[model samples]
Target: MFYSSSWSKCLICLIFITSGNAECPKPQVEGNFVLTNDALLKNDFPEGTEATFECANGYLKEQGSERITCTSGEWSTLELTCKKKDCGAPRKIAHLTYEFGEEGTLFGASAKAICDKGYQLMGSSYRQCYANGWSGRPRCEVVTCEKPIEIKNGTITEQPDKEFPEYGGVIQYSCDEGYTLIGNKSIECNEDGEYNSVPPECKDGNDIPLKPTTTISTTSITTTTTSTVPPIIRDVDDIPLKPTTTISTTSITTTTTSTVPPIIRVSGRNNGIGEHDTNAATGNAAVVGSVIGTVIVTLIVLFTLYRFYKRKGSYQTGEDPSRKEELLQFKNN
Candidate 1:
């Protein structure tokens, strides 16, 4: 009985040791290796539990555990991790500028983007590291606005000299003459670089009046007169009646005549006697007579004045109001 009891105690001790050893399973030597958070580590399994390692879409198997088993209740190692997809981070750009990561970190499953100086970011700043082993490549672009110069009737006179840095560029407007500009004089570049208002218009000017016309008419009329004459008369003593000899076949004769005088005027004449005269046959005799008479009268007056001067020179010596002569002087002896 004593021997049997000692044997039973030893068996109980062995069973206890076995249970403890199984529970604490030695660090896995051959089960499998696992990658965790970009690192590889051996894991000890727990009682009644099993584990398996798998990479996400953007990850790959490098040197990590794919699966582990619990034979006596001990695990192999911690869950294995998958290396990040080999693809690089999405390209980053700002204001048309770009930059790249110094050391591409794909294991962390994070993607980064950046732009160069003087440029600004346009789209999403971040990206995802995909299971395919790469981050979504982002696009970088430039930003710009619209230009000014909205033309209505006519076109813009000219374009800007230089490219506008801002959104809206500037332009000036003009129109053909006889037409007036109705809208804004100058155009501005909007933030989007578009014109603000519609183009100007061309209008007409004022009007003037005209002159008038007229017409005229003329007419004429005629009249006639008739008369009968009595038989010819004779002196009382010698009065002779119609001759008896010619009474059988008497005949008589009659004649008529008409005359027109030339026209004349009396203007610009020195005297009342002018170009009017009865001498119709002499066309210019009266005019010539008038001119000759005037010349002769002038010569007579000049000769009389000369004679009066000679007489005065021969006799005159003293000054008298009536005589009206300044006599020549003689030297005294």
Candidate 2:
């Protein structure tokens, strides 16, 4: 009975030894970090063994210990926290600046590029933080315009000495002795790094176009003479006169002649004179038709009022017919 009790004691000791020698499955670090190479190669991590972790690329250890201890056939909790690494600012360029996003210059973040006034962006307008470093080489450059095109028989006066004119630069153009400038007297550089208008042309004085002729048609009872009106009022076409009674043998003769003022204003912009359009004729026809229709309406209203007073007498109950006549007259006028 003593030997049996001793054997039970020995078996209990052996069980404790086996349990103490148990090995942990494995240790795995989260996405932002990784186990050391030596720790990853060997999965047989015995109880009480230690494993160290390393931060992944573009990440940095933020807090807590990177090392963890294995105990009781299971790995101990890792207290290491990781955060994105900062790439810092890139090399500076003239007239260039950067504004960061919510994440700033840390990995995977972006920055916006800005240029000073009178300067333009010449490269990518954004920079990104990548694994290696910031992504692009952004730059800003002074605004400039291409040289004015060559014009035959003309020379550009007050021209800038440089190959490209800067913003707000002014240039005057002049023609040779027998030539004349056919556009604006000067071209100025604008904020867009371009001239306000194309360079003027130099043409021989004899080749300049003559003023255009304008013709207007009209109708009259006895005689009609040509007359001028405000330039804003466009010429109108002949309007046919319909007699009160039909006469089969009568015919009308009409004629028109005019010399339009100089249509080409040297503003280097459209002056309502270049392209041909039917809108002007349409507007004139509408105006003439509206006047004739208003006159006919006035006559009809007067005739209606005369009949209303002569036949019906009172304008229904207490309504005033004179008020309506006054209103109609005001509208006709």
Candidate 3:
């Protein structure tokens, strides 16, 4: 019984000493960190024990080992350190601006992108910081409009370049000579790829009056004067029943008269009437008078020849011998 009691006491003392020596010193970190794969959250560790350290959110490990060990009742020397994650300054984007959502450019931080006036964004408007770098890189581009349609009888006078017009660009319009404009003289490109107003059109000028035509005609006439025969008087009883007229012995003379009338013609631009001149009337009268005189002389000669022939025939028959002889003697004389 005494031997068993001594052996039990020795075993108890040895177990107590072993338990005291096995306990490890607590480890101190320079910055915010946590043990890797540790579920208990214990501050101490046993001899020959190992652990890995991880930095807190928004922090990164710097110039240190992430692994440590406990040995001989003490913790091994740890050079572990942590610092705030640093994403460099934001990159410059043409025609774009940015705003930070947080004070530092650390993990989980973000920035918002904004396009300048007359500009547009080609990518995401928000950027986020990560362990490697920024989450996205956005770009800015100038807003543009479609090509303007051509105008009839007009031209664009103030276009500066051949490319598509940008937002807020201006185009000036003008009409050709002798044409009138029907709309605005200038138009501006808008964000919707169109102009603010419709383009102008050209119209023809006002009509002019035409001149009238007229025609006129003129005619001329000439005239001449002439003398005419005078009428003679004779006693009524002086002439017997013959067609011939007897003349008195006081320087007897024959006179002829014309009955022909003058011919007149009418002619003008409007078919107007015209009168005969005095010369034409006189010429017609002269011609008619000459013909009348010839007829009178012929009739007188015929009557004389008829009387002579009858007397000669009577004498040849000897019916009135004394009278026929007297007529023959007179004819001979």
Candidate 4:
């Protein structure tokens, strides 16, 4: 019994010795930070052991202590505040403007480069903000125009210095004696790097081409139509005919009579007026009829527009309000 008690006491002592405060897992917290040299080297963090941190790249400390302690096998909440570092405003470039994006001048920000008028960008237009400074060096180059093409039988008497031509530069041309200039004598280099007008041409005064005298002739065709000059018959029997119309809204019907001019057929001999002459007369009559129809339609439209304006004016004008009341009363009745 005494030996049994001694064994039980020894077991109790062993268990107590084995169970001293357990070492905490590696300490960690939520934020953009890195552990100190001591904390990173050691894998084990006993309870009450403290660890230190520093802000990561591109970030600077804002507030709060960088140190934290492990309590009861757990890391304390992160109290360190780290904010993005500033790269400062970019340097001013000649003829260059910038468009800073959100979070301006801070890390990871960007600026779009814009060149002024008569200039163009030469490098990457986008510059990014970094932990050290901006990413690339962008520049603006002035716009220029190429030399004008040579004109035939003409000479470019006046132009900008042979080196290069910029915006608003003009090139003047002249023709040789006995030759005349065709188009504008001068071409200008506008804001965009291009000639504003086509170059002029030089043409000899005696070298002009003319059209043929009988160029109005129709193509080769043999006609058998024998009718000679379709007679212009104007009488009461051939009065202008119209179709019938009926209005359902007013229960009104209008009936009209149509009279077709007689078709006079002649022998199938080649008369002075054959198919060509007959067709030409018909075409003339059609053109006259189209002109008359257009005039009549225009008059009708003008009358309709006038009547609409008169009706609208009657409503808008302050004349005879009592008359409108009387009309309303008549309707009700």
TM per candidate comes to 0.30, 0.52, 0.47, 0.52
Deviation in Å, model 2, residue 49 alpha carbon = 0.6
Candidate models: Cα lDDT each: 0.47, 0.71, 0.67, 0.71
lDDT of 3 by residue, 13-55 (tens): 9998888768565566566777666723777687777767888
Per-residue lDDT of model 1, residues 265-311, tens digit only: 33222223234444444434544554556556556655765675465
Better of 1 and 4 by TM-score: 4
Model 4, residue 331: what's the lDDT?
Answer: 61
* TM-score: the better of candidates 2 and 3: 2
Q: How much is the lDDT of residue 310 in candidate 1?
A: 61
| Decoy 4 TM-score against native | 0.52
Q: Over 4 Å off in model 4, which ranges? A: 1-21, 176-180, 203-333
Error of 2 at 280 (Å): 36
How many clashing pairs in candidate 3? 0
- Better candidate number, 1 or 4, judged by lDDT: 4
